[model samples]
Target: STNLSLSIDDKFIQSIREELTDLQRRLLTFSIYDKQTSIKDLSKESALFLWFQLFKDIIFQLPKSEESKYEMIEQCRQYYHGNQEELTNIEKFAQTYTEQDSIHWYTKQCFISRLCNKALRTQDIELLYIFRYYIQDLHKRLSLEHQSFRNTELNPPILTLYRGLKLTHDDITHFQSNIDSLVLMNGFFFTTRNYDLELESALKLSKHSVNILPTLLIIQVNVQLDHVIFAKISSQINNSNEDEILFDIDCAFKIHEVYFNNKKNVWIITMSLTNENRLIAGKYIETNKREIEQG
Candidate 1:
């Protein structure tokens, strides 16, 4: 007779981390593989989406506290324990950070960006909750910039943006297949009007591995669309150019085209902003509001 035990790998741990976004998520997501006729499936989907909105709203509404800020810095210290420069930056951040410096710190791409970007990309709710104060500050700054766009006459009716990056062949293939589908980016979308392709964006293929693709995203936005919020962020941060435009989190885009530019030997994917978020979650938000008011 032999005894067998189950083992979880890094990949399985990652999937579990993504699924467990909040304390209440277990009630909604547990037994996704089990067939249960007790509840309507669509309702569960709606509830999960609604929970995300509610979770973010609650985090944003919570009062800023010195304790939360200190905890964030401490977590940064622990997370970057092996990196001396990041630990030094964490110490400085703990001692001298002001509310207004949030946007600058984020764009500086230091420890804050490192944590925030990873949390967003991986849907790491625990890390996101810890950094809620800074996240709210960044969102507020972008919101103000977005609002100011309405009054600026210099703002164009149509804007073109570019982002240079490298992706796996599978990533490019997914884009190619989902040409007309909606793309909901997990975090802030960074693009520039005059993007010079970065050297790092070009992946060097070797005999051992050649699954990389250089991707250049061409995003066009109709400035007339008021549903999604985006703003020019170059002026907000130091040591930056004027070409940076940032789309806020949770904004949805429609993929219009995807093709390989044979001349440049890179993939060119085009997308446009859309109001799909409102289309999907507007009603749930209203119901959520009503339930909150009733409770």
Candidate 2:
């Protein structure tokens, strides 16, 4: 019997050791192990191997210095000035892995999130749009699988990208139509400062009857608005001056009371808003149920 073999030169091994980060090296090692241990697993492992290399090439090529950081920011700002062909090629490359089923859904979401963060940090609108397309596809797939709630978790970063790009009204409405109401509301929580839109999203969720989170989000947003802004919105609801009054003041107060009664833990609300705004501006309205009972 004869066996075929190949050898990797020491120079090549040394080059890889110098070039690859620890994470990349570990992924490569796993790929090799998967290939040798189970032939059937080779496809997925190989895909991951390629994906990691591409990830490094695209994401990790930048140096880890402040100067490099500024350069990356500037590069992202001027991405439009780059060769169109090159940008299109990069977008196409990302699309390939994004459409593949070899990676786990959570892993894919995490990878896309990283790409989104980088895109935002660098103001790379082209890459951001590419990421948004992938996320929209993911949301569709997840909706079919009845994992739409989990899909909601994947939306905030994409929404941030939209805000960064200053997407048109049609673009925003198109996206809102494709996603679940909870996701739309959650996205609004992070991406929009408009009190009317926030209230509208919350009201839409309230119709579903199980959407306590949106109600809590509404309360959070209401508490955060500047006193003057809040007063104007309150006045609109009170005087029926708004074109569409989703809920009157008493109705809104009732919903807030229900939320406080059901969710006694203040930390839940605080934790939910942790990543939402740097300054969590919501004042928690204290429930007077205990006082009423004592009386």
Q: How much is 83 displaced in model 2, in angstroms?
A: 23
Worst ten in a row by lDDT for model 2: 247-256
Among the numbered candidates, top TM-score falls to: 1
Clashes of each: 0, 0
Candidate 1 residues 160-210, lDDT tens each?
A: 778665566767776776666656666666777775533223422211237
Instruction: For each candidate in turn, give its C-alpha RMSD to the true structure in angstroms.
Output: 11.9, 24.6
lDDT of 2 by residue, 8-79 (tens): 465677555443321221110111112132323334533443333233234323333444333433443355
Give the runs in model 1 whose Cα sits over 4 Å from its true position: 1-55, 153-155, 198-209, 284-295
In angstroms, the error of model 1 at 141 is 0.9
Q: Which ten contiguous residues of candidate 1 have the minimum total lDDT?
A: 25-34
lDDT (0-100) at residue 122 of candidate 1? 60
**Against the unseen true structure, what C-alpha lDDT does each candidate score?**
0.65, 0.29
